[model samples]
Target: MTEAAFIDIDWAGRPVRIEYQWIARDRAAAPLIVFLHEGLGSVAMWKDFPQRLCIATGCRGLVYSRPGYGRSTPRAAEEAWGLDFMHRQAQEVLPALLEALGIDATRDKPWLLGHSDGASIALLYAASYPQRIAGAIVLAPHILVEDLSVSSIEKVRAAYLETDLRQRLARHHDDPDSAFWGWNDIWLKPAFRHWSIEAEISAIRCPLLAVQGLDDEYGTLAQIHGIARRAAQTELFELADCGHSPHRDQPERLITAITAFIQQQPHGDKP
Candidate 1:
């Protein structure tokens, strides 16, 4: 394990600072697994899942925060994220962060392990840069924001406003409002109700594993089913009694599934 490093990179004509933690089992050579966080996720929010998975697979791991969440710069107060925010993450932020860290997208097509919004981001990234991804494990991903998603988001807003949900989330983000409002406002918006990325998902060529919790409140099983519908090389896993966060809900199962998925992919380095 190494200490976290903070780096500054130019993103979309502005300077954006990023904090990342990298782990290498073989300093001389190792494949990479890039971990993307969920809607309200930060590097810290991932807990020890990245390390566990990397150790299990004997691969290097890259865990970092998006622009608006975690230690990264806060989103401009006036900047309202568009429906394509996830696309921007896949197209812009992810590529910028990888380049800044000297992770070659072409030479080392890293495995992607993403949760929730991060899972959607992974799907979009694979579609945009299919050749750059080896394999992917997406937990609680959303290809289309459904009525269930909106209804759940509405409940989240109410919880944040009426309960101590904000205080709980404050522990994970430097600016809780930046993380909470950015996700909540967008998910609860009327226009966002129709937000869907199924068209883009069709372009993904890498092996994919889509996992969802049976008890997921934010989304339904349809999310993973939709991914399987588009991508030919896709597998689905529905964990019983699990919720939105599969890694947290069933760490052992999540790890096992990912390890198996990577081992099944010919391109990924063996454990």
Candidate 2:
């Protein structure tokens, strides 16, 4: 079973509400696995994937919506996100959320599972707080801006304007425009083309699993390959038929890989 809850925290000098859910709460001593959603994803958008993963691994799971998505606080329409938006989330928002929830990573040492933009944020967080994370499993993470990413985002922009993208996204986000533009505009920015975290990832010391689809339109294998080059401990998985979102495209395979990876870790034993 999953329990949904909210925490009020301060971000950028304003009170923001974060919606989060806990899966497998009965497993108090089990390792914690935090799920970071995609750019346009929310807690509700993840559906039952997090819960299913936690149940399979005998671990506790935490899934949450970022400040500007899902049922959480929406971004101001006029406010523009900077090139370092993902960096800010990893360095500032994540730490605050953990503290507010009384989760001491130094003591518990949670593992992170992030997809798409969330995966990039996970990489940044792991790099910044190397000792706090047990390990990280990132799916379709972007280490640097690629032409493919920008081009795909451009297509999404067109869809949002000419298609039903906004309407479909509204089913998941409280303010679909806030969620869509915040991610789209930042990625499409001219300055953002230079955004890269390859150097910083070298600081990570924990085990890492970087998975990407062979057919991912937003990024190429270079994303995970780059992580392996900088972080020697990284393991890469390239799924042939999968796309950007592996959980949705290849859920069973992803679960199997994740379970085996977690069990192989030094702290793998189930509590």
Candidate 3:
């Protein structure tokens, strides 16, 4: 396992310790792709995907576990996330991490590769800070909440309460409850049904690739389709025989598609 490093940043009037690792850091001048994990994911959960993708794309990779996940600062027991959680991560947490690490977004304009909730954050970041990102490739991104998504979340919640889900997540998160509930409780909230980023994503000015799994139980094809409709820069890809986690489900194909997409960038590296 790659040794992870920690950086502390103050967010929401509290100090947060973020755990991160650099892949192929020796590629000094290569363009960077920052890897954002899924809601329940941590740098540990991402495993070798970041390294594999970076190798194929010849891009340096930054993989980090957000607050409340992995070995980072866990969420307070009483803390509950709001509808704007994703937005807060995009606007505050991400930028803070970059600044603390001395990564000047104005110069590097790194690309973002995010999964699930992280994918939504990537889209929000690209939209909110157009000049700070060169492009984004989102896997199983959710633009708006669907009944299917709520239903799946409900099931996962039950499994967390009834099954070994907690024990399983223990391998990834320092406190699985902190990772699971923070994501679950918010998504299942009644008012959360109205959560949507359709308008905000229209402001995205960077290269965008929004991908969805045809068989994703948490969402539908509408997710990427909707992004393409709202964001002119977005390109949509729907993979067959895949579920929510494409990086795990269809890594080779996903990697191939992603490499092709990034290589298409004017200054992106080629295979």
In lDDT terms, which candidate is top? Answer: 3
| Model 3 segments more than 4 A misplaced | none
Residues 1-271 of candidate 2 have per-residue lDDT tens digits of 5566899989989999999998887788999999999999999999989988987888999999998999899999998999889999999899889999999999989999999999999999999998899999999999999999999999999999999999999998889999999999998989999999999999999989999999999999999999999999999988989999899899999999999999899868677
| Alpha carbon lDDT of each predicted model | 0.87, 0.92, 0.93
lDDT of 1: 0.87
* TM-score of predicted structure 3: 0.98
Comparing 2 with 3 on lDDT, the higher-scoring candidate is 3
Per residue, candidate 1 scores C-alpha lDDT tens digits across 84-147 of: 9999999999998889877788987888889999999999999999888887889999999888
C-alpha lDDT of candidate 3 relative to the true structure: 0.93
Model 2: how far is 94 from its true place, Å?
0.6
TM-score for model 2? 0.98
lDDT of 3 at 124: 95
Could you tell me every candidate's TM-score relative to the true structure? 0.96, 0.98, 0.98
After TM-score superposition, the amount by which residue 235's alpha carbon in candidate 1 deviates from its true location, in angstroms, is 1.1
Worst 10 residues of 1 by lDDT: 22-31
Q: lDDT at 117 for candidate 1?
A: 96
Which scores greater on lDDT, model 1 or model 2? Answer: 2
